[model samples]
Target: MTHTSTAQTTTDEFIRLGLDVLDTELTAIDGLRRYIDADFAHACELLLACTGRVIVIGMGKSGHIGGKIAATLASTGTPAFFVHPGEASHGDLGMITAADVVIAISNSGETNEVLSIAPLIKRRGVRLIGMTGNPQSTLADLADVHVCIAVEKEACPLGLAPTSSTTATLVMGDALAVALLHARGFTADDFALSHPGGSLGRRLLLHIHDVMHKGERIPLVDESATISQALLEMSRKGLGMTGITDAGGKLLGVFTDGDLRRILDQRLDVHQTPIAQVMTRQPITISADVLAAQGLKLMEDRKINGLFAVDADGYPQGALNMHDLLKAGVL
Candidate 1:
C-alpha cells in the first residue's frame, strides 16, 4: 500500500480533481437540455406576458444567483428586482403586485423562508414560477410553472455544497432572459439604453463629432505646407497626424507618423520636402454622424490609428485617433 502527504500530492492529482469537477458540472448543464421543453416555453410565455416587473426571491446562496438573474432580466429589457424571501414575510411581499410575476428559487423546493410567503403570493393572484431541484416538493406543487434545475450531483467533492446546481440555475436564468429578449424584439440600441453607464452605451450612442477634435484642435494644413510645417502641426495638436485640405477646405490627403517613417527611411529632407509629395492621397474617412464604434472598426480595418471625419461633400469636419475613443469610453 502507498500513502502520500497533502504536500507530496503530484500536480496531476490536483489537476485531475479540478477536471473531474468541471466534467461533473458540464454533464449537469447538458442534462438540463431535457427540461427545456414545454415547461420552459410556458415559462417564457408567462414572463413575456408579464405587465409588471419580475420579482425574484430566494434565500442564502440562491439569493446571490437571484440578484444576478434579476440584473440580467432588467438589462435585457425585462423589468426585474430581487427581494429577500426572509424580508417578504415581514411585509416586503407587499412589493409584488397582481400584474407582476414572481420567480422563487430554492434548491430543495422546501426552503422555509420561501415557502412561508408562497401562500401570500398566490392569495394575491401574482403568478408564481418556481426553480427547484426537486419538482415534487411543496414549492413546485404550488407554482404555476416549475423549472427543474436538478443536477446529478454537486461539483463539490463533499457532495453537499451548491456548485453544479447554482451554475445550472444561472444558465437557466440566462435562457429565460435571452428568450424574452428575442420574443420582445430587443435590439442592441435598447440594450444600450438599459446600460447607459457602461462601455456598451458609449459604443452604441457616441457619434464621431462627440469625440473628434474640431476647428483649431484639428491638425490641418494646406497641401503646399512644408513637411517641417506639417510636423509642427502634428506636434502641436498631438494627434500624430495632419490633414491636408484644398483651397475650399475639402480634404485632399493626410500625413501621418508612418509617412514620416517612410520619409526618414528614404532619407528625404523634412526641412524642404513638400507635404503634398509624401501625404497619403484621399485617405479613408468616416462620416461625422456615424457611431464611434464604426470609426474604430474603420481604423482597425484600414490598419491605422487615426482618421478624419468628413461631411457629405468630403470636407473635413474633425479628426480623431484611437486615444480619443478610449477617452470617451467608446473603445
Candidate 2:
C-alpha cells in the first residue's frame, strides 16, 4: 500500500475506535435511567437530612469522579467534599461525622481502600450511600442505601480499563445532586453563592448597582442645558451618554454620541440648541436591582453601549457602560 493509503487507513481506524467507545458509553448512560428508583430517593433523603456535609470517598478513577461529584453537590447547595479512601483510613476519617453522609463510589463495590475505611465510617453512625456497578458487592450490602451504577459492559475494548462504568457512575452522581438540589428548592441565586469566583456567579449574583457609576460619576445634564453642555458632561464622565433631567431631578431624555451624530447630520447648532430637543425621549433603562448580566443583555439587544439605572419614578440613579460590566466580570 502507498504511504497515503496507510495514513488514510490509520485515521479511519481511529475514528471508528472513538465512535465505538462513545456508542458503548452512551448505551451505558442511557441504561442508568431505570436505576433512579426508591433507593436513589433514599440516598437523596439521607443527604438532604444531614446537617453537616456529604463525604464522598473512592479509589483511583472512582476517586476522581467522587471529587467532581463533591464539587457539583457543594456548588448546587449540598455541602460536600471528597476524602480519598486511603487518606481516610490513615487519618482523614476524622472529617466524617455523624451529621455527615458518606457517598462511596466503587465500580466493583469491592475496592480495598474504600472497604478498609468502611467499618470506621459505620462505627461513626454516619449514613452511607454506596455507588457501585455490582449490586451484590460487599459495599452495596453494607450501606444504608445503594445507588447502582451498574453498566452492561465497559467501553474499553479489552474490558480491563474503566470507561462506560465510570461514565455511569458520574451520571449517577449528577442525578443524586440534582434530585437534592430540586428537593431543597435550590435557586440560581443559591448556586451563585457557592460559585462567587466564576463567570456563572457574576452572571447570577452581581447586580447592576454593584458595577454602576453612582453619585457624581453619573453623567447628568439639565433638560434646559445646551447641546454643548451635554457634550461636555458626556466627555467629563466618559460614559458616552448623559441623562437629561428636569428641575426635580427626574429623567426627561437621554443624549448620546449617536444623538450627537444625528444633530451633526441635521446641521443643528450645538451651542444654540437645547439638549432635550436633540435627546432620545423615553430611552431604554434598567433597574439597579437587576443583575449585571441583564444589564449587559439590555445594552447588547438595544444596540447601545451605555445605560442608566433608574428608579421607579424615572429618576436616574446611576450610569454604566460595557466597560463597567467587563471590569466587574459580568461580561
Top TM-score model: 2
Candidate 1 has what TM-score? 0.90
The per-residue C-alpha lDDT of model 1 at residue 191 equals 88
lDDT of each: 0.94, 0.92
Model 2 off-target regions past 4 Å? Answer: 1-9
Q: Residue-wise lDDT of candidate 2 within 64-134, one digit each (tens)?
A: 99999999999899999999988887789998889999999999999999998888889989989999988
Model 1 clash pairs are none
Cα error of candidate 1 at position 205, Å: 3.5
Q: Looking at candidate 2, what is the lDDT of residue 103? A: 95
Instruction: Compose the digit string of candidate 1's lDDT tens values, residues 95-179.
Output: 9999999999999999999999999999999999999999999999999999999999999989889999999999999999999
* Top candidate by lDDT: 1
RMSD of each: 3.3, 3.0
